[model samples]
Target: MYHAESFAAMGWETYIVGYKGAKLIPSLLQVPHVRELYLPQPPAFIANLPRLLFLLWAPYKILFQALTVLSTLLGELPYAPEFILVQNPPSIPTLALVQLCARLTGSKLVIDWHNLGYSILALRLGASNPVVGLAKMFEKTFGRKAYAHLFVTHAMKGVLVRDWKLLGIKAVLHDRPPSHFHACEPTEIHDLFSRLDLRPAGEDFLPPSSPPLSTPFTRLRDLPPSSLSPAFAATLPDRREDRPALVVSSTSWTADEDFAVLLNAMAFYEKRARAVNSPPKENPQKGDKHDRLPKMLVIVTGKGPLREKFTQDIDECQKLWQWVRCVPMWLEAADYPLLLGSADLGVSLHLSSSKLDLPMKIVDMFGCGLPVCALGFDCLSELVGEGNGRVFKDAGGLAAECETVLKGFPHAPELEKLKQGLVLQKSPTAGEKWNTWAEEWDRVVKPIVTHRPGVE
Candidate 1:
């Protein structure tokens, strides 16, 4: 979407072809200069067949992808495109198919390396698996032959260049959030929360004496932060100035990212919150009671295949936990960024499939001036640096990090300090690495996308 949007803004007509029902940024389709060609998904009976039947599935899967992509790129496009940009990982037959189609259509192929398809397969099947070995060889053959290559991290670029001996243009294209993501105003937050119809975690957490109330969002839209309620209080809980800690995390719920890590962290956090807030059985004394983790509402957003299972896990966790509420939801494109901006803190459990690609969610969180605690991996430090975020290796570490930053919640100086650091990073002059998507696109990508034969 970023590539298409940027190209469209640069006055170039862009064509984006993908599976018809796959999730796309809704705003992408609205761009006047961009045309979208959606391909049909394979028949449900074929696609939904048990995964163990690889014999029946693999050939159909490859043929479907190959035929659809080839037909769309070659037969349906308005004109013969100068270049075709493709995302890697599910590279498989797509790479081979796209490469063949690109040749037949007299177009250049640009490969965007998000991660290695072989590495992702290694998570499910061991590295020693023969199929994984074949995937690596296939990617090497096609990926290395790209007209240009875009990498998300220096580490990935270095590794691929050295090992695969890749051909053509290569550049580290760091992922930065688009302009839609920024710290939202109080009114925007309130409007989103009101529409969410946020219920309390349970009766034990807060006792609501009155029936649920409603607000006309239009009337509240123009109000200032002071006139508006704090975001965490927008739920059906106490309407006092005090608010629950609002933490947001978004995921597609794929197998690569272990959702269980977050579930465990939330459980750990719940225990700590309860321990800190509960009255002691012995001599009753309050010593710096305010300096403890606040009750939290952890909103996990985005949809995926694992959503039903994850929601079931959340339900079970809620049964035993009182201080934190974990709920799964899907947000509209515009509201997604607003929620991130309105959040007190963000959590990312994106254990990268290849350990060489940084989580895009962390980038969005940083863009919204929301500091994050993200799962650590090889190339993560490139995006998640010291002040704005912290890295955790496990669920316990994540819980501890969350407790550190959010300790005195609602008035957490630690969280505010991180947020300030993220705010500074929005400036192009903040540091070389802080360049916005537009600036970086102009510097690194525009030249390649716009280059002409025999033209400087």
Candidate 2:
């Protein structure tokens, strides 16, 4: 949706082709320069091949993809787009068709890679699988043939660089920002949160009489520090504001985003908080009466089978924290600005296990100006930057880091400086990465699309 919207805004006609029935695609129906061609999914009976059989020869999968592309091309010729931006992974065979059509018709092929599907699939299925190896070879060959490539993270580009060093490909590193920012407003945001019935975690953490920290904590690096303008700071009541702590939020309620680390971290945070409130080494109280224990509330906003499973885990950890709120996945475009403005931090946690690539929520977090706290996988840490984000090598470390981060909420002077620095350094806003990417495509692709062979 970010790419399509960006290109459309740049005055280029962009058509997106994908499986027809998935309602979860980033909604792009309203963008003026964009159109969609949804293809039907393969019949379940045919697609239900055993893993061993599917892995036996995946080239046929590519051949089937080509058939899908051929059908789509025959149906879409009337549009005659100047360029074709093909998102790889979903339609491997369609990519070849798009490339062939573009070469013949003078249209440029821009291969957008969110994840190296073959590499991920291979990782999941084991490298010994014939299909996985074939797919990797096929992907490399196709990448070499592409006119241009767009990778969501430097890590992804690194993978291609290591694998295809001789190709001299100009693979661009692009960012995905939210589509709603083009026209989001405060009232719309407030209304959206109200509709969602969401509250700030800190408010939920403390009693009404306790004064809340004036500013939310956030990390800053590679761009201007978030403190200079207070532009993206969550608008909680302003008290004596110190630099806000880096706040990261994620619901371990989905298959894609890992919940175990989050659950463990919740447990760790409870332990650390308890330790902080415990009696000093010199004096030990036999029975201290405290009204409430310090806790961090994590608000979740999605649903799935994974969510159902993780809800039990979250419930298990409630003995330590005051509450764990898992709301329905009801947030809309209008709600983001307010949440971004009010959120001190943002979080996206995913398993390092292959198949789950970059989540769009990371882009949404950057758009809202919240520094991300995400598991370090493929391209996440590279995109989030070392200073502005935190990444764990594995699930074991997540709990300790989460506890350390929460206990040390935005209290340091350096934290404020970091925010100020990022604000100054960021050129096009982080949210503008996709928008800029669309313009770059026009510059490189338009002339190629329209150039005459005989003309200089």
Off by over 4 Å in 1: 22-27, 44-51, 203-240, 280-285, 452-456
lDDT of 1 by residue, 196-286 (tens): 7455355456433232242211122133456647863423322233567888889987778898889899899988888887767785675
List TM-scores for all candidates, in order.
0.89, 0.69
Q: Rate the local accuracy (lDDT) of all candidates.
A: 0.79, 0.53
TM-score of 1: 0.89
Shift of residue 405 alpha carbon in model 2, Å: 3.4
In terms of TM-score, the best-performing candidate is 1
Candidate 2 lDDT over 121-145, as tens digits, reads 6545676777677767767776666
Give the count of colliding residue pairs in each prediction: 0, 22
Find the candidate with the highest lDDT and give its number.
1
